[model samples]
Target: MALTGAGMSTASGIPDYRGPTGSQRKGSPMRYEEFLHDPEGRRRYWARSYVGWWQIATARPNAAHAAVADLQRSGAVGAVVTQNVDGLHQAAGSGRVLELHGTLARVVCLDCGAVVPRVQMDRRLRSANPGFAEAAESVADELRVNPDGDVDLPEDLVASFVVVPCPVCEVGTLKPDVVYFGEPVPKDRVERAYDLLELAPALLVLGSSLTVMSGYRFVRAAVRRGQPVAVVTDGATRADGDPVLKVAAPVQELLPQLVSDLASQPDDDSAEPAEALAASR
Candidate 1:
């Protein structure tokens, strides 16, 4: 099984939280409790997301994503579990991807539980706030967008921004379908990931720091089960000492070569994992 994180999509221009450059935005991300309890927080989230959503919605899959898909096609990788919500792995043609966090491509009504495509919500926001996008673009030249489509904007701008309710429910708050800080990953998702991990001979981690337990717990589980683990990332990770093989390199530069080397080897499985890991190094 393969596990990926925000760094997996960084090559496509989305920034990861707690990376070398740190968070791109000024304030902390919206916590689930805050988002649910505070009307002002919800308004602020939707306002920034209204403008920043375009960045995530438009991002394309990079070489790392393609390489993973190729590895899967070659039977070197069986399943993928990702902490990222960007849907880039699916865009790259990977079939059995499990999104640990929910996707940004969807929005769900807090009250009604009705789900809608993010593009449709974008249209609704645009229709409700006339000229808002144009005005925001002009002033947001210095703002940085995150993978979850959050951006830093002035308080005054956020105040001026308008938020729309769910069209179906009419009373519920609408939020991107992602697991926020202070929110729990649904039980079923966790179970499904564990099931995949059980079947995998080894765990291959790509482009993740595993700083949050949400993504890190799986690594811990794998290690406890005596599964051989390999990690490919550019910087320090929580699982640094746990992996049987740890390679510090950019995924975009490393994955294609690993895929090529694996493809060239014999169809036999015995020598493949070690040979591929050594060749990648």
Candidate 2:
């Protein structure tokens, strides 16, 4: 099984929260509480998201994503569990993928619980705030998009942006389907992840620092179960001090090599797991 994080999509132009240089550059992501009760905060979020959506929307699956899909098809990887809200895994042709957090392809009404495609909301946002995207582009050098598909902007710029109500209820605010910081992943999602983990012989962690419990808990669970854990990333991870086989490298370059090495190995069920791909790292 494979577990991926924001780092998996960073090669495709998305930013990660905590990877190489992450300690120095990572910004605080939006929290669920502020988005739920603070109208201004929510407005700011939507405004930034409206501008930053292009980065996430236009991003293509990178080499790492393609390698994972290749391995999955070759029977080297069985399942994938990712913390990314970006749908790159599915975009790369991977099957049996589970998005630990929700996806950005959808939007949900806070009051009515009505769900709609993100493109639907995008069209509405475009209609309500004409030239807003172009205005943001005009000051492109000033904007820094984050992993949550938002960027910090000048208050004056955000103040002029218009927000629309949900079409179904005509009163509820709409929010991205992604799970925000301080928000819990739905119960069933966690259960399904654990179930998949229990059945896999090993957990191959790619591009994640495992900084937060949201993704780190799976590492702990794998460790407690005596499952061998292999970590591939460009920086020190929370799992470094643990018993995991740590290999600090970029997943974009290394994952494809891993698939090639596995394909070259003799087809022996008795082959050792550690010897299967660790040499490639």
Candidate 3:
């Protein structure tokens, strides 16, 4: 099953990327081209992402992540395709997670392509800006991981912020490996996820809008393959009318109950759980 976007981690206190209460400004986050071309933009991006890492590091998976992992453990789920960079699913004990967007907890040097643990940069950030670590930890819960490892901070407080350079290449800047808007998911990653989807009998979507083409493409692929597509989310999604089963509820609240209900069904298999739920209503 594929769980797209930040909503999967919303219950864990991380905000969504773009929703009524999303973390973006003007309904958008920083773009890749802007980060590359604008020095000030890059500075701000890195600054905020650095602070946001505190939250990312501390966030634990919520019930939804656990329930999905339970499905994986039972072999009812083959894989979890996710767009989030937070790596919470693995923390939640999920075994077969396909992180479509790269992890936020690591850094990649643009010049040499040497990967470094995010902890190294965090220590550097603390050492470079003495009291900034305290300030970052204080506001960590609200911070969102930006294009680079920088996070968003209040504008008034940004004046005290400083962007740290890559330790490997003093000249080159470091950027998080996450897939930004307009950046295509690496061809190999997409292909691997597609291959996994082929193994599952049904596609279960949770807490995603599927607003981006990267995610919507999967929903389309499932439909074309004649697989049952079920969605559990709060608001309207690209899959709204197309899904075989639509559960308009918060995933953290619905998933465990749904799993329990399915577990209690008759062993004769006279009725499908989805059909029974549909009839009960």
Best by lDDT: 2
Each prediction's whole-model lDDT (CA): 0.87, 0.88, 0.73
Candidate 1 lDDT, tens digit per residue, 1-281?
99998878999999887674323434577899999999889888998898888888889999999999998998889999999999999999999999999999999998999999999999998898898778877887666786569787788888888889998979788988999999999999999999999999989999988888998999999999999888888888888777468888889899999887877766664457546877878
The TM-score of predicted model 3 comes to 0.86
Q: What is the number of residue pairs that collide in model 1?
A: 0
lDDT ranking of the models: 2, 1, 3
Q: Which ten residues in a row have the lowest lDDT in candidate 3?
A: 19-28
lDDT of model 1, residue 68: 93
| lDDT value, candidate 1, whole model | 0.87
Candidate 2 Cα outliers beyond 4 Å, as residue runs: 21-26, 268-273
RMSD in Å for all candidates: 1.8, 1.6, 3.4
lDDT (10s digit) by residue, model 3, range 1-281 = 75556677888877776663322444357787887778777766666766667777888899988888876775556789998888888998988888888888788877778778888978887777788756765865755553233465766566676777778778677777778766779999999888988887878787887877887788899899998887777767777778557777787877677556656667776455455434433
User: How many residue pairs clash in each candidate at the backbone level?
Assistant: 0, 0, 10
- Model 3: colliding residue pairs: 46-150, 48-150, 48-151, 48-152, 49-149, 49-150, 49-151, 50-149, 50-150, 50-151
Model 1 ranges off by over 4 Å: 20-26, 267-270
Candidate 2 lDDT over residue span 256-281, tens digit each: 98877777767775345456567876
C-alpha RMSD of candidate 3: 3.4
Worst ten in a row by lDDT for model 2: 268-277
